[model samples]
Target chain A: MKKIKTANYDICFGIEGYAVLGQYLNEKKYSKIIILTDSNCNEHCLPHFLSNLPTHILFEIIEIEPGEEFKNLEIFTGILQTMTELEADRKSVMITVGGGVVSDLGGFVASVYMRGIDCINIPTTLLAMVDASVGGKTGVDLEGIKNCVGTFSMPRMVIVDTSYLETLNGRQIRAGYAEMLKHGLIYDAAYYDYLKDISNIDFEDLSLLIFHSVYIKNEIVSQDPEESGLRKILNFGHTVGHAIESYFLTQNNKNPLLHGEAVAVGMVIEAYISTQLSSFSKDDYEDIKKTIHNIYEKVQIQADDIEQILSWIKFDKKNYNGNIYSVLLSNKGKAEYDFLISKDLVIRGFKEYLK
Target chain B: MKKIKTANYDICFGIEGYAVLGQYLNEKKYSKIIILTDSNCNEHCLPHFLSNLPTHILFEIIEIEPGEEFKNLEIFTGILQTMTELEADRKSVMITVGGGVVSDLGGFVASVYMRGIDCINIPTTLLAMVDASVGGKTGVDLEGIKNCVGTFSMPRMVIVDTSYLETLNGRQIRAGYAEMLKHGLIYDAAYYDYLKDISNIDFEDLSLLIFHSVYIKNEIVSQDPEESGLRKILNFGHTVGHAIESYFLTQNNKNPLLHGEAVAVGMVIEAYISTQLSSFSKDDYEDIKKTIHNIYEKVQIQADDIEQILSWIKFDKKNYNGNIYSVLLSNKGKAEYDFLISKDLVIRGFKEYLK
Candidate 1:
């Protein structure tokens, strides 16, 4: 087992780390258990998880609607109703077993159930295992707004068994891999170098790389658990990435860009802004752009579209005092905070990405 | 203005203290604002609040259905959809301006909106301004379970304008008064002495008592924000109170006990438990019983009802390690924790209350 400790959170990774579930449950002495999952994990992933549990233990499975749109108050109510019908009490524990959406919604449910209850996370998707599961962020989307409702309730334990990755689709794998690459670019250049030959890597190697990526995120989260200072570094690509995602979400014809895909593009564009304002070399900016573009197909950004997307920047969660603050790269592996880049620079970055 | 400071939380009471709303919003630099209210408050209390706002500032109001049944997933979704339609950006703040239900649901909405946003609570009801507004607890009810879905997200500011209580119904005023009596029974003899003549008090004096009650709750909360230790003292009457409340909820009875009403009875019954297990004087237990019976009508507790209520105790939020933990007062002004009194003792206590 790989024992990883960050300032605010500690996570254990590897093959049989799944055992941590039973151990923590025993320690907390929860008598009743409820497992929350989506339709996807209920069929493909939950059986593998259930095989490890003791048969005598009484537990119930709450299946919510699958995907991001389902991550809202409707599904949250469903889980609560299920818990109520099953007579799941305050001593009951909810075990989330799916991707980020499932964990986020389930964690929100547990946090509010009778004002709060203990929960354990068994993240099935790579995006969740490396990022969502470790942090204390639990919430669901509201209407067209993404992640509009949530809480910062930490789980008692997070069991990440990469064995679940075997069933992930190619699109899902690549989407998750984009975030891992981001961890490398934002914090450790050594990891970036390791990820350069991504197309040639095997699944086992991919899992090991994911563990390392989670370690970097875990380290930063532990130090700034509340996202007051160092934790903002984890949102390196998210500033522009979220705006781009929202832009696509508002447009009817274009396919919605996956979270990691949007961030990959965001990293490239923000890198261009970095070269303009900081000591980042032209060569380094090109390398970062080339690395992300190699894996993520570039989306077209027309002049009109650039104007629309720039308008959404003010809506970014990090904005304060009417200024859109972008998390920029001061250097290849270091992130700088709270830079109020101008609208012209944002338009210029979008133009550079289009080229 | 009454300026009171607890160890961690500060309570600013009185009419002009509502200006704290503008200061917090200006300091946080919120670009847009939305005020959440219920029908009751909108008609009776909102004019008092809105007249205080700057004339140039435009704030949207979202009205939700009032009462415990409305505090569910359906309303949570309705509010989310409303916020989305209004284009409530991440920089927008949600100001909850009603009783406990509105504050709880609105705070939960803010905690999850865009993964979290700033929320300010302007509590109108006496129960809300004193008890609900101070704690960081925010949630909605699910099925028959009260506050089953929630998060512990603190508000940027909690504006307590006791002047709103002038419009409260006679029952609403008495309901809030019960909680004040509870604070005295568990932590302060002087406060209890003050509440002895509570029946003769007018609305203006009730406002002063509400401030004092909130002060006691805020002090307890500051010391144990997470409810791990001394905070359990606040649950003094909640154990049996909650069970009785739940029991009544399961039946199709008219005029079910409100939260405060059930708690008033719970205090009486738990006092008997305290007398059995500790240095609690018989005189004090009888006084508690007689006092609550005088203010609130006694509900008949048959043998079958006691068994049903006892069964519900296991589901209490404070339960740990399969053991039913009760917070009992060793005497007035002192509380004992983790007392694992037997079911027989609880039944005996119920019998004592019956006599």
Candidate 2:
């Protein structure tokens, strides 16, 4: 619970991260300690954090509005200007205290300021704790291009304190569970079995589960930090998942689907694709479809939605030179990456998903 | 000469870079080859480079306007859009075929596109050949903040073809020499002695000198790629030099001083500061002053310019909290970094330069 050392830095659990943060500040004696947070975290998580921090170093807060629209070059420039005004030199340590949006943009700010500076992540959501805070990928969107500019830079350490989950409603925490489900599906059948049919997720049990989920992600990232080969497996649900997420985001009538919900749907359909194209068991595909439907409300991908969804799927970043490449399941608890899938199979999967 | 091995990649000499590039293209068989340049390089250096490339690989060009005004996030985003349209995938190699502005922006494009792709620099300018091409410092200016967004990424190789220097004027080449003089002032006194009193620089000899200049920079850069300490010596003239450059940049009454002109003036003033604050020989400072004055037209810094220049100096990126740090001379050919010089000494150095 103290610290789990990975390829680049340690991932500290709960209050142990605070203890380590105190030690780190005392030893490094950075020119300044800057806290990068959003207005949401500043209101919700900051008080608990500041009271618990066992350090004498007075820190400064750089708070941005809590949303993705604010994550761009203009905001990036504003942060730099603030840092310049604060005289935050290369010796400054920027501790990001919020969810993925905060860390994604702030981590990038830390990485590029003066060609790079040190950063520590304090993930405040279940989703961020399990996924965004574990990996080194940090970037900001450009001209509406998502993560168009980024660098793979690890933080000095990651602090995942599950107590922050108390601030979130059920839907928010469940959105994080989607990534944990993907982690288990790809690596450990035993882990997947525990969560596959959960009638209720106990908060205390979920903390231990989040720890295991991060450990899985950290292990994969350590082996392939830059996503050359092994790391592509992590994109299993994201290819179709992101497309579905984008589709719903554009529609004004439908409520915005939580990322975990869209990804859950992606997993079911992709699991179907795996059985048809790869060595995945047909029975496993059928089981996934039923369980995912039972867990989350089914979104109708009607005949009209089919073509638009297919277009979105083909636009995956992994696609190259007119070929669509994907991470599909070869078997339960194992994932195969960079598999080229045809458009017909995708349409057929959507047809199957609809049925 | 074929190649000079640096810490990360080779600094290919003349046509040898093209030959190595041919072999690299065949060996790597990248997803695609993208040529990033400006209208200036596309018009001037592209044809000669194309004929000598010795490769069968059909490459596409991503050209932009040819000036610093065009080097910003809008341009950076446009290039990304063009690359996306071209299907320039992760395996694509972006060969920057121009001077610093092109390379600074293009190199950054290559480094960040798909979270970083392969980049090869083909520097067409003399200043870029010996300095920018040798070090992997690629970035874009943001909202008047110079190099506010960048990454310390090395190229696969640098193509330093001297034939491109034919397109430059005499002032352009001499501008490059100011940096060469700096290399000798910091790391090699013997190198300085060779160029100090040269009344006329033969083009043939200049090429050889440029090779040595790049070699010196690469040596210092390799030892400290991220500028922890040793690499700061490379900024010997740059601290005060940048201030002078910024000052003149604002004045519409005067023609823009070439970058080398500002740095030459900086080297003289800082050399004077060195003699006062450090163990530098006064005779060496006097020799540098007289020789530099003879080489470049001395730009007068009247009493009015002093306060503005002083303001710019304190704004040095190396300055932390409120202290001004610089790379000052400890001796001839020996530079000491992170030297804290008092304001009085800096003012005295300027007074000496004016005298």
True contacts kept of each: 0.72, 0.47
Can you give the lDDT of residue A300 in candidate 2? 73
Compute each candidate's TM-score over C-alphas: 0.87, 0.95
Candidate 2's displacement at residue A306, Å, is 3.9
| Tens digits of per-residue lDDT for model 2, B174-269 | 787898899999999999999897675788888888889988998899889988889999999888887787677656675656667788989998
Clashing pairs in 2: none
Deviation of model 2 at A121, angstroms: 0.3
Query: What is the CAPRI rating of model 2's predicted complex?
Result: medium
Q: Poorest 10 consecutive residues of model 2 chain B by lDDT?
A: B140-149
- What TM-score does candidate 2 reach? 0.95
Flag regions of model 2 displaced more than 4 Å.
Answer: A250-256, A312-315, B250-255
